[model samples]
Target chain A: MERWQVVTVVVAGYLLLTLLIGLFAGRRVSASVAGYVAADRQFGLLAQYFVTGAMIFSAFAFLGGPGWAYAQGAAVFYILSYGVLGIAPWYVLGPKAGRLGRRLGFVTQAQLVAGRFPSRSLSLLLALLSVAAFVPYIMLQMSGAGIVFRAVTDGHVPFWLGAAVSYLVVLVYVLFGGVAAVGWTNVFQGIIMMSVAWGLGLYIPIHLYGGVGAMFERIADARPELLTLPGLNAGGEPWSWGAYSSAILASALGFTLWPHLFMKSYTSRDDDTLRRTVILFPTFQLFLIPIFLVGFAGVLYPSPPEAPDFIMPHMILQTGLPALVVGLFCAGALSASMSTGDALMHAAASIAVEDGVRPYVRLTDAQQRLLMRALVVVVGAVAYYFAIVQKQTLVFLLLTAYGLVDQLAPPVYAALFWKRATTPGVLAGLAAGIGADLFFFWQRDLRPFDLHEGILGALANTLVLVVVSLFTAPQPEAHATVYVEPEEEAAGATVEAVA
Target chain B: MRARTARRLAIAFFALYALVLTYPGVLPFNRIRPLVFGLPFIMFWVALWVALAGVTLWLTHLAARRERRGR
Candidate 1:
């Protein structure tokens, strides 16, 4: 058989395995909305660990990470630095949020906020913003899948067919299993990604340059610029420290605030499970080291890929590795894309129904579950159509989405910790923060010191939240205490009972 | 150590990590030479901090657990 055919068969085998795991896992959950949206709040340490890691390191990390390392050099280090910083706060916030979620029956980030603040429009706004961010983000994951298939299969499978087929599999499991399927498949995918990343990461450099040190030594002699921090910009110009530092700061702040990630706090089996997940998180962050090595291996290769993003597949194919290895690599890349894509689809649909529609229309629990399932398909179809048919670039929107997501942090912080935060203050702060972020995003040249728009927006958001909250009538003392200083002993007992 | 003190120290460590890994703080450590364990100095620097963060967080968890058991 031809090599591409062999590769295709292996990939097909992998996808079938993923489908079986997802479908099987789906059968174990209850049929309630909580079951679908929050995995019935029973994810233990292992489940929480893989789900969080796999979702965060998406097709972007698998493919774009190497691409950045290949073309731009150390600019990719910014990606490396922020993950721990982003997740560390979760150690404190995760259990606290989980406590609130269980008590209030909140399964979404906006629900958590609107629960504290009690505003319908605020919930609607959050739902809208989250979906806006999620659609383009999901579309990008599809594109990443298509890119891998097309690159590795020698274009036997076109981008459209590749993306459609893979996502069709994703839609099935997510529809049937809900978050349970997402969790289990992520466990499967997460293992594949780490193994392939390390296997190829180490193999590539040693095979080509004799050792990891040798590869770096050679690059240092030939392309030393790639070894330094705050690497080159898209234009290949030297990147300023201002842009680099702010990228780290903005991304770190916005990381856990992504609605999908924040909601994961609601999925943990117990507060301990959540805390342990945060502690174990850096091991996953270390996986990026191998991923970066794969990109650096391509730096001195005889030929260059058409685009830097193609570097990983380009290297695998160029090196003429065994057909089986090539196939395994393709499966790993798909895992990265599909794991993230499923989470986005599931979260977007859940958020839409829970926060977007439920407030305006009163629906039975059965009706709500049905609506969530239907919306999952709808969200998938829309993202797939844009990914395959319209083929628009969603990178700009994804970046803007980060800035928008950062605006969520202030309200969430106020809800859990600050007692004085009022509804009007939250609403006004969200509006001003989003406005400032957008203003700077569009007027890029006007930014002071080339700072990320998200940081600027956060500053505006906090300032407005503080000022506006002081001027407004405070929430009743009784209501504020429930969130700010809930009796820990009672909360812990309830959590244990539920578990 | 007291749970509160441990928590305070963990937060301080994370804050110091944020400072030293970015901007003016990172400026001193960012370099290609003096490769440690086959990684560039800056790369090693970032990885070291991340690993240390894990240790710090684990200790904080233990401290919190001890305090809770006492209560």
Candidate 2:
């Protein structure tokens, strides 16, 4: 067979395998809303481990990670620094949230927070913000997939067709199986992504530059700036320490609060499973080391990719590796894109129906499930449209999304940890935080020391939450105790905490 | 270790980890030469901290488990 044709066959086989696994995984869950949204809360440690890890290592990490390393230098280290910082908190918060999820039958993050605050507006606001943040993120993933397909196929598969075909598979599995499909598919995709990353990451440097150390040595000799911290900005100018540091802080803080990831707190079977997942996250996180190495491998190459994000696929094609390896690389890239896309679509839809629509409009479980499935398709189509048609640089939207989600941190901490946090306090804080974040985001020149807007927003949000809570009447003692101490604490010594 | 102590230690460890990796704390270690594990010093520094975070978490997990058993 011709080379591209053989690669096409391999990719086709991989997609078919993912589709079958997703369809079969769907059969494992019940028909209830919990079953669809939280996989019946039955995922063990292994499933939880992969689901969380794979969801975090999105197309952005796979493609943009290398892109950042190749173009922006040590700017990519910010990505490396943030994962463990973000997930370690989950060791405590996940189980606490899980206990509440079981007690109150909450399926989404908004439900958990609003269950404490008890505000319809809060729930609607969270749902809208999550969906809005999700659209650009999902668009990034879709375009990431399109970029890989177009690169690997030598333009035979256009960006639109590649994205549509791949995401159509994602839609089928997600619509059919819900979170269960996402979990199972992530396991399969996670393995592929890690293995491909390590294989190529090590092989490329060794193949081109003799060894990993040797590659860095050459770059240090030639382009010394790329080897240092804070690295370079998008315009290839030296990056500010303020930008670099705040990116890590803001991303780490906002990491678990992303609606898609936060909802995973409701999926684990037990507290131990949740705790172990957090412990093992660092191992999965180390995968970025190889990812960055691959980008560094591209630094001194003769031919440049059309864009920085295309460096990985471009390098693979240029190296003239066997078609099978190229095809597998394509599959790995798709895995990164699809794994996260499925989770985002599933969470956005669930949040929309459960927290957004269900609060104002009462719906039966059957109706809720139907509406969520419909919303999934709607969200997918919208993102796909932006991915193929507009093809806008979504960096602005992605940053704004993180800043917006970071605003959720105060409300969440208030709900689970602080006894005196009033609903009005949480609401007011969210508005102020988002407002400050947007203001700084637009007026970059006014930012103090080039700090990320998310960091500024978080500070504003926390300050408002505290001050407003002090001014407002505390939640009624009896109602607040359910969240502050919980009824189980009265019965015996329990380790329930949100620390 | 007591459960509360374990939790407190874990919190302190992470707090330190975050502090050490950001801005001024990271400035000292952010260099190109003196590669460790065939990686840049700054990159390796971040990875070392991440590994330590895992160990700290495991220790805390063990402490919490012991507390549960004692209860």
Candidate 3:
């Protein structure tokens, strides 16, 4: 077989394997809503680890991560910084969320928030924001898949066909399995992702530049600026501290706020499962060291790919490695893309039914499941269309979504931790934060010092939430206590936790 | 509760992270000339803290375990 043929056959086999896993994982699923969305809350610690880890490490981390390292230099550290900073809060917050999930029978983030701050409009608004944020994110995964297919096939697979074909695999499994499929598939893919990341992250530098230290030595000697702090601008000059600082802050806040990851908190079987997930998450963050190394290895190569996002695939193709390894690299990248896309497709569909349409109309469990299944196709269709045509940088597109989702942080944090925050306070804050974010996003002028728009929005949102809650009547004390200190705290505490 | 103490420790841990990983806390380590692990000093500095953040959180995890035992 020809080299590309070998690559194609290997990649095709990997996709088929993924679909089979998704199809079979659902056999154990319950017919009830909880089973579909939260995996019957049966995921043990290991499953919980991979599910949450896979949810966070998406196409952006796979492709855009290397892209940032190759394209933006020191700015890539922001990715590393935020993943840890983002989840560290979860160590404290994740158990509270898990407890509340069980006690109130809440699975989605908006459900929890609206439960605390009672409003149909609030539910609908959050649903809209989450779906809006999710589409681009899913688009990110889709396009990341497209990039892999296009690169690996040497343009035989066009961007549109690659994205469509890849997401079809994602849609089928997600539609059938729901969160169970998302969990199992992540386990299967997470194994591939880490191995591929380490192998290539180490191999590329060693292959081209002798070693990672040797590669950095060359880059430092040639383009000293790429090695320093305060990162490079799009123009390749020094980036401002305000931009650097806020990007880290905004990303960290946005991490736990994502609709899918927040929902995954409910899937954890116990508090220790949630706590252990946070502690182990940083090791996954270690994967970035290799990812960035892979990108940095591209720095001094003669004839790098025109677009920085294409650097890794371009390097893989250019290198004369065995075709099987090339195919595995393609599969690894696909793993990165599909693992997150499945979660996103499932989350978007779940939100559309549970939070978006539920308050307006009642539906039976069977009916809601049907709607979510259909919406998976609908959301998948929209993201696929955008992925085929959209021209934005994959990492930047993901960041834009993160900025918008960042608005959810204050309201979510308030719901879990604060006793006094009111419904109007949370609602008004959402409006203010999202409004400011949209306006600044369109205008493109920094408020000053180049702080990211999301950081500015978060500040505005928090201010409004606090001030409005003080003036407005608080959520009823009895209602607030359910969240503030749940009735079943003892029951929720694991023996390992309480012993 | 022990959960509350664990929560406080986690908060303090993240604060220390924010200090080391951002802005002025990271300001001192920004240099290209000194290389660690074949990484530029700034890159190595960030990588070091990334490793440290894991260690710190693991310690907090242990502390929580200790608190649980005490309870």
Fnat, 2 decimals, each candidate? 0.72, 0.74, 0.82
Q: Lowest summed lDDT over 10 consecutive residues: which window, candidate 1 chain A?
A: A390-399
lDDT of 1 by residue, A1-499 (tens): 9999999999999999999999999999999999999999999989999999999988888888898889889988888899999999999888988988998899999998898899999999999888987887898899889989999999999888889889999999999999999999999999999999999999999899999999999999999998997888877888889988988898899899899999999999999999999999999999999999989999999999877878999999988899999999999999999999999999999999999999899999899988998999999999888777643333334556688888988999999899999999999999999999989989999999999999999999999999999999999987887888777646666999999
How far out, in Å, is residue A486 in model 1?
A: 1.8
Summarize candidate 2's per-residue lDDT along A387-492 as a digit string, tens digits: 8775444344466678888988999888888999999899999999989998998899999999999899999999999999999988888787777676465443
- lDDT measured at residue A299 in model 1 versus the true structure, 0 to 100: 93
lDDT of 3 by residue, A1-499 (tens): 7887899899999999999998898878898799899999999988899998887898899999888888788988888888888888788778888888897899899999999888999999999999999999999999998898888888888878888888888888898888998899999999999999999889989989888888888888888777766778666778888888888998998988898998998998999989888889888888989989888988888988868889889888877889999999999999989999999989999998899999999899999999999999999999888887788888889878987999999889899789999999999999999998887777667566788888888889999999999999777777787787774544456654877
- What are the clashing pairs of model 3? A213-B38
After aligning candidate 1 to the native by TM-score, how far in Å is the CA of A34 from where it should be?
1.0
TM-scores for candidates 1 onward, in order: 0.97, 0.97, 0.96
- Candidate 2: residue pairs that collide: none
Candidate 3 regions with alpha-carbon error over 4 angstroms: A487-499, B1-9
Model 3, position B63, has a per-residue lDDT of 80
Candidate closest to the true structure, highest DockQ: 1
